[model samples]
Target: MKPVIRLATAFSILATGCAFGAEQHVVCPARLEPDAVQPNRPPSGWQLHMLRPVYLTEGGMLHGPPAESAFLVPDGGTSRKVGKQSGETQHWSFDVPHGYTKWMYCGYGGGGATLKLFRQVAEGATECTLSSQSADGVIKEVVEFVCK
Candidate 1:
């Protein structure tokens, strides 16, 4: 009788889809535009680093500067597929470093673009879309550092 009850309980748990597994959630950060004037010019001890346009592929890596405080990632930030692929273009996702609540993305080739920040709940990782519009076929990285 005890065995039967245990089996029923297990079945019920499985039916409810309560299986233990890592679930990912998106953490939205404060997005900033290129022309947006932030009152806090010099955010504490942080500095601005201008990254040249880096041609990226589907699985390529967009390396951030290795400084005292880099919101983006210095290395190991892999590109991920987001939406459907059109022509020879593909959308990629670059995970930002944790603890960074603010970021700015400026596109040179494109007219204007938006920066979307996302955080992985399972791994607690923060990331953003590299570029939504690549008119000249290049995406630039703009990073503003701030003392956390």
Candidate 2:
């Protein structure tokens, strides 16, 4: 089945070319298979932390550890950076396919990982809001925004 990329929080799928009327829609979701991927650097074996890894066989991202955790916010969120303690960066880059609306992500932080979805833009790629959720379900932090 084609995975539906709902906001999981919001109700907008901009990739579908639909004017959201407070209802979420579906566009194709990216196939994020790690085993089928080639590394841009070396896999850190860390959770959800893709190294200068090649995403979707097109682009590659390199990360440097973040200082404080970040989150994807509403109404104007675009790319986000999550930091690690080992001077390593837990970066996220989306090379979404055409007709793809939402970018579905499932990640967990060791201490607590921040999750963000890049907001949309007219030119180039837009980013989503960043929300924080821990791996072990022990902690939950506030979801930050670009405005505040």
Candidate 3:
């Protein structure tokens, strides 16, 4: 079946519950536009990148070791760097796809500081929020961008 159909089916199943007498689980893999993919980056075409990697502890991430660099991608597919320590602010340009209504996020605890997001405008460009802190610190800001 086409990916969109498959995704819809999965959600339908999840929302209404199994049709049969037994419990069923539907897993739908994300579909990507092959031509839009870039090497060393994640697949695109997803409308929502939910619970996307935001922070990791000193051990790297929730699942493994320290990253060469820490970052999170929200707003459909725009990447924002999660710095190595708490309270660090890096400027991010809102290159998010149009039509997304709001961006939401929260950080992991490690640097004894909370992760914060900020917005600003510079030279007519929309400057999105930055992920603060942790060179050796690990955090994952659970972020979401919802469409209007």
Candidate 4:
């Protein structure tokens, strides 16, 4: 059963105190190499030197996890991995480094984090989606806007 909290109560609580890192969940999705055999966590590839992390509004069934989290969590946290595909439209990609093939992807929400992906399509080709959900069921679509 869903816990019931009065609107007034919520307002009172939020108004009373605001916690740091509460909105720091929305994060860049991870990516793995095409031939990678490992699962869980970001493949050794998903790397961003300047993520410029920001927080956006997260929408969910009210039962969703916090924004910047994950959509379908396995153990905890958000990550990704993938296999080689014929087409290049896949939302996932990677950069090979350290002699090991590492995959890479730019997503608005948590993408390519699943051991096996269901949807690998993104909105933009070169640009990462500005709005995406997390594995924890958190919605961080409005992160950029919120930060702005």
Candidate 5:
């Protein structure tokens, strides 16, 4: 009787675990194509601009050792540096051509920090701003822009 009871309890626990696992699911966005062009100038009518800030913090305070460099890469293009600024933040702009709609802005930093921006702006929208942040490393903030 004792052996039978032990087996029954073990079986019930295993069944419950399996049922919970079966209900768990994860959803992810579709992959994008590799970047092909890194044009030196914007296409014709539109433009994309980006800003990145790098910093270090300690004990909830905004001061520490200088952070490693950060980079921004637009979809269908190569990585570009955010030019230096007076303080911790850096800024740069990219040229987007007329009729170009979709964009994926990626930010990378030393020490494995990363951030991403996935956005779709309206056709007549004159200006739009999108931003993202990473939890760790040099990339603290990423701000993107699309303007007519």
Candidate 6:
């Protein structure tokens, strides 16, 4: 009888575990737009990173900077540079861990800038674009994320 009782308990526990695993999780957004004022955050189990080949636009011309400094600033966390310089563009790699409220992009050596925030909504990686403008010694940084 004791052995039977033990087996029953084990089965019950297994059933409960399965039920928990089957529960539906929150879905991520399809795409996120750029927001100069506010930061953006991703859903659980999703990772955030700055995509490579950062581009710069000036006077209606688009080009990559020889050496630019970019950072990933998380809310209430230390900021980190994207990556080392490589050729024309920066190496560009920084991951924002899940569950940190929100994050924003900050870049140096720009006149003025704007920011665009995007939230990822899929399992795979999303390619986002950040555009900034220089004005009045103010640098605005913008980031956009496109969901796959």
Q: What does candidate 2 score on TM?
A: 0.22
TM-score, per-candidate, Cα-based = 0.21, 0.22, 0.22, 0.17, 0.22, 0.19
Q: lDDT for model 2, on a 0 to 1 scale? A: 0.28
lDDT string for model 3 (1-148, tens) is 1111112221212222223433222211122233222233334644422233223222111111112223334333223343444443333344444533222223223363232221111212343333333344333331221111
**Candidate 4's residue-wise lDDT over 3-120, tens digit each?**
1212221111111111441321222223323322322344367632323332222311111222223332111123342332111111212221233321121222234322222222
Write down the lDDT that model 4 would get.
0.24
Ranking according to lDDT, highest score first: 2, 3, 5, 1, 4, 6
lDDT of each: 0.26, 0.28, 0.27, 0.24, 0.26, 0.24
Query: Largest lDDT belongs to which candidate?
Result: 2
Error of 6 at 78 (Å): 22
> CA RMSD for every model?
18.5, 13.8, 17.1, 20.1, 23.2, 21.6
For every model shown, the clashing-pair count is 2, 18, 16, 20, 1, 20
Error of 1 at 73 (Å): 8.5
Q: What are the runs in model 1 whose C-alpha is more than 4 Å off? A: 1-31, 34-37, 41-135, 139-148
Which regions in candidate 3 have their CA more than 4 angstroms from the true location?
1-87, 109-125, 131-148
Question: Which regions of candidate 6 deviate over 4 angstroms?
Answer: 1-118, 137-148
Clashing pairs in 5: 42-95
- Candidate 1 lDDT, tens digit per residue, 1-148? 0001111211111111112542222211122233222233445677543233222211111334212223433333233333432222122244545543332222122333212221112223233232232223332222211111
RMSD to native, candidate 6: 21.6
Candidate 3, run of 10 with poorest lDDT: 58-67
